[model samples]
Target: MIMQVKNKYVYRSKISEAKFRQIVRLFALDLDATQISQIVGLSRVTINRYLMAIRERIAKFCESESPFQGDIEVEYEVDESYFGPKRVKGKRGRGAGNKTIVFGLIKRNGKVYTEIVPDCSKSTLQSIIRGKVDTNSVIYSDKWHGYDGLVDLGYGKHYRVDHGKDEFVNGKSHINGIEGFWGFSKIRMSKHRGINKKYFYLYLKECEFRYNFRDENLYLLILKIVRINPLFLS
Candidate 1:
């Protein structure tokens, strides 16, 4: 339905600009579909669709604003986290089954980027690092075997925290920043009780977008992104 919005903009949507913007506001507030439907007087299904679209938009925005967006000189922290419900009793760490692997990299005091990976293999993780980070920057991580040859990748310096020996901090050799983000993401995702694996990537990117712009007015930022991107609501 290609419709004109107030004679100023055209959108392939069944929703008016005002209604779309209202939905955007509620979504920016982090209200789930039920809460948003109650406030906006829309069906839960409709609200859910809009929310899903919004998350997709947010994912695209985060991808475009990746951490190393020409700012590769600064130091960085990298880590991999496994996300899943506690299904196997007494199982801890990446050995658990049905868990999704996510690789993340963050610039110190800057933005973050994340990806749903097949595994945390050295090749998988390091390839992402090579693509996003230049060798002129310092890299920090835990002393995982996967992170063994970061300096060999031409990085200026590779510092590591030996978590196995409880050596968490050795001056600037800490992955605390990315570790903190992993904790934050787990906590936030737990609130949803559970999510389908198919949509997990969208949720992960949403977390990255949110954390990267945590200090700013997210409502406005999202609104601006939506305005330019335009909504093709069903």
Candidate 2:
């Protein structure tokens, strides 16, 4: 389906929205182009073209400015997760082998944001928070030393749940939401037996998008993804 906008712009595509959606369903099944073509009754070349377009469009969509403004009020939880080699005996923290660091923030009602960071240093973690979160939103996290002194930096409320003493929750002062997401992310990654670092963020974004939109049908959801064209049109 094509929609003409402003008379001067024309959108033409071979796939209808419904068919595009079906093709997307095949992709979600972890199928390759040839496999999707056989299942969806389309040429392999056509399927490849559509898949490439989908990836670029989604990347641009992620960078698009969100309408979320103001205090951005939502229950926020912050935490860090690691990705790397299997654990061995006697390893802790930095000793847990070379791993990439990921920071996560999730809302109480179930929205999530995640990104890769070089490390969990005070500067790195705090910078991610300042960029993605509204200063007035309450920030919840575990008692990681890296998060110390956030109040000194103008946050509305900085609450910590110390896991050292087995304190998981203190009247909703916990990071269980984000931590749950971290566990989910790891489980998804295990299917791929570890992903390349460059593609890790893309996979992470896909997971966050799926988790946040779990109520939608997987087939219809991906069809909407296939319809997007990423070329910048003036």
Candidate 3:
């Protein structure tokens, strides 16, 4: 159930390299494990195992890659979203139960970075922003009080869109890019019905990878990452 390649062991559970690559290709195409199992003629359990392996590899690859840094002269959007089961009939936003908080930053026509945070408090969010974003970057976000002190935190400029007033954009300020990412991630995850909370961070990183490489050959890109980080399979 293992194969050694270039002196490194690559896990293979009775799945040939060709078939494994096929499964990965289907995965890149956004097929659910069940759908891929039907096409590849593999059992759903086997397919799901392969997916978990791939997702773990993706998580390692993303961790090896450095966080966003340097000055961002161009505009960038920052936002936070909650991910989890839908609320039955409770208050929305902040106090909703069964929700996981995620913070994200995306540059206009550039890459994106996301993380599962403990909370959306100003201190928590500000620390992350200071580390990942440049000190003088132009940032755009909704009127979330957590992001209120960003201007004083050394950003070149900070703009807010009052979503409470039904305003989503102003002359040159909006979080449409990051918000679009949230929608994209939610829709994609919906196909899986639901993901386990324990592995949600890995799935979240996969979403980040997908969005960051949206303009490139995702299949080849994934293969490249795996090839470079072959030890991730262990």
Candidate 4:
């Protein structure tokens, strides 16, 4: 029950490639493991396994395109969202419990890059910004204290939207795109009821991949990604 897409990487499975692809298609359609299991006639455990492998490959692909996409003046929006037990609403402080902090940077009209950070501190966020964003690119963000000092740090093109004062947009300087993505991610993730902390990174990356390529045929895109970067290394 092994299916090898390329010579080196192997996808060990009892199902045929077509069946596996059907499973993948279901997964791309955002069906949970239970739904895919029922349609594909596979056990939930088996379905979850394949899905995890697929997600691993997707995460790898997303990482390979890091520092955001396009070298030109692709305006970037940066934000941090908290995924906790009850809601997705923490900013600077992590509060308590299994509150996971995820930072994201999205190129305007392009792909999004995400990272799970220790905190929404200035240093933690700025390090990622300094690495991912170009000094010349225009950046947009809400006036979170974590996003402070970007202008002093050489990202002079940075713009801020004061959500505290209810100012979301100022000319073209708004973080509505990234903020919309946060809402999208939260809504989709809530369908799972609860996600385990250990596997949360993979899930977050999956969300990023889906949102970044929301307009494309995800099944084909995933297949292309897996084809290029095999899930299992020989």
Per-residue lDDT of 1-234 in model 2, one digit per residue for the tens? 555333111145445545666666776665667888988888988786766555455555554624233446666899998876776667778426677788887778757777778888899899988887887788999889889878888885988888999999999799888888988878877776667776666667766766776776755555554444422222
Off by over 4 Å in 2: 1-20, 28-56, 65-68, 71-73, 88-91, 230-234
Who is ahead in TM-score, 3 or 4?
A: 3
Task: For residues 1-234, write the lDDT of model 4, one tens digit per residue.
Answer: 455342322344356667877877899999999999999898998888888888888888878865454475669999988886864455334434558888988888877888999888899999998888888889999988988889998887888889889998999999888888889888888998888888888889898989988899999998778767655522
Report the number of the highest-lDDT candidate.
1
Model 3, span 12-71: residue lDDT tens: 345556776788799999888899999999999878877887888888887777646554
Q: Candidate 4 at residue 1, lDDT?
A: 47
Whole-model Cα lDDT of every candidate shown, in order? 0.82, 0.71, 0.81, 0.82
Order of candidates by TM-score, top first? 3, 1, 4, 2
Write the residue-wise lDDT of candidate 1 on 1-234 in tens digits.
Answer: 455555111255666667777887787777778988998888999888888888888898887775686775689999998898665887665637668888999999888889888877899889999999888888999877888887777885888888899998998889889999999999888877789888998889888888988899888898888777865654
| Model 1: lDDT of residue 73 | 66
What ranking emerges by lDDT with the best candidate at the front? 1, 4, 3, 2
Off by over 4 Å in 4: 1-10, 67-70, 87-98, 229-234
lDDT of 2: 0.71
Give each model a TM-score: 0.89, 0.75, 0.90, 0.87
